[model samples]
Target: LDRNATMKTRLTTLTWRGSASVDPRFSAAMLPWSIADIRNHESYVTLSVGVEDGVLAAYNTDFELQFEHKLRYILGYCRVIVKQEKGKKNADFLMPKATSTRPQPITIGNDNVAEIFGPEFGLVYLLKNPHDPLLHIHFYECEKYEQVGWVSFLIKAMELGKCKPSRH
Candidate 1:
């Protein structure tokens, strides 16, 4: 098999599991009541990379699909605004706590995708397409633990996605 075929196989089968937590600083600023909340409050999450409906996709827990973007090598440079999944609540709270301000969108490039995973308040990811100038994925997390493994998995996913066959 060619290299692209191998990469496509790996990307479609890649899966990683880990827990997410709120960053103490962000939590203190936004959800002061949760300051005492234990790290990794969400317990566990599973993320995967795959192709759906002919587009490269990222799947969150329970096989729920998130962002979909074209492969950079196939589509050339482009820009896509990563949006939150509909109906997905941020954190476990019934409603967002009252705050003077709302969360802001974070802009990231291919090189900075991993940084999003390390933030204290939000979960962010980079879409597989490197040519996208504004590609990013963002979500809320109170605290995160076992991030080293998560990062490793994500990096591998990104590498695999880069080499995925264009025909898919």
Candidate 2:
């Protein structure tokens, strides 16, 4: 075999075996068994849209969805306040003003609070920022966050081959 092909085979063989130096008890979850088949150059994996939706539902709670809905509602009517300074250049630029409609108090659902899984942060429910996709708020334990779930652009991450477990 050529040098590149030989190196690839060796790497795949080593990855198929559990680590030599580490005990199984100390390790976290193992890579899904499909990794072996997926390593083949001609291999392809097919996932159904319904299965994808179901998995998303399993990780998301009703409260969290409601929270996102309310935030979206408030932001829909939001506008930036631009005050013109006396001596500033381009101070006359027109800006959107807040709606005249009275602002009502937003009452969120019970899931508005974080579910504590540990002494400090056991579970982590992330709220994604509307303006920035990469930013999010963690609701539960920082150390044990993944025990609950993670917020990520799964499709984007997988497309870029960057979807490994972040903490581990």
Q: Candidates' lDDT values, in order? A: 0.35, 0.22
Tens digits of per-residue lDDT, candidate 1, 87-162, equal 4423332222223466333223454432222223333233333443433322323233333334334444555665
User: Residue pairs in steric clash, candidate 1?
Assistant: 21-142, 21-143, 21-144, 22-141, 22-142, 22-143, 23-120, 23-142
Q: Model 2 over residues 1-168: C-alpha lDDT tens digits?
A: 233321111110001111112222321111111112223334222211100211221111111211111122111111111233574422221222225464322212132321211122222122234454342222211223232223223322332456542221
The most accurate candidate by lDDT is 1
Off by over 4 Å in 2: 1-64, 67-119, 122-136, 142-146, 149-168
After aligning candidate 1 to the native by TM-score, how far in Å is the CA of 47 from where it should be? 2.4
Minimal lDDT window, size 10, model 1: 74-83
TM-scores for all predictions: 0.26, 0.17
Lowest summed lDDT window (length 10), candidate 2: 9-18
**Deviation from native of the Cα of residue 17 in model 2, angstroms:** 40
Stretches of model 1 off by over 4 angstroms after superposition = 1-7, 12-44, 50-55, 60-67, 70-123, 126-136, 139-164
Clashing residue pairs, backbone N/CA/C < 3 A, model 2: 118-122, 121-141, 122-141
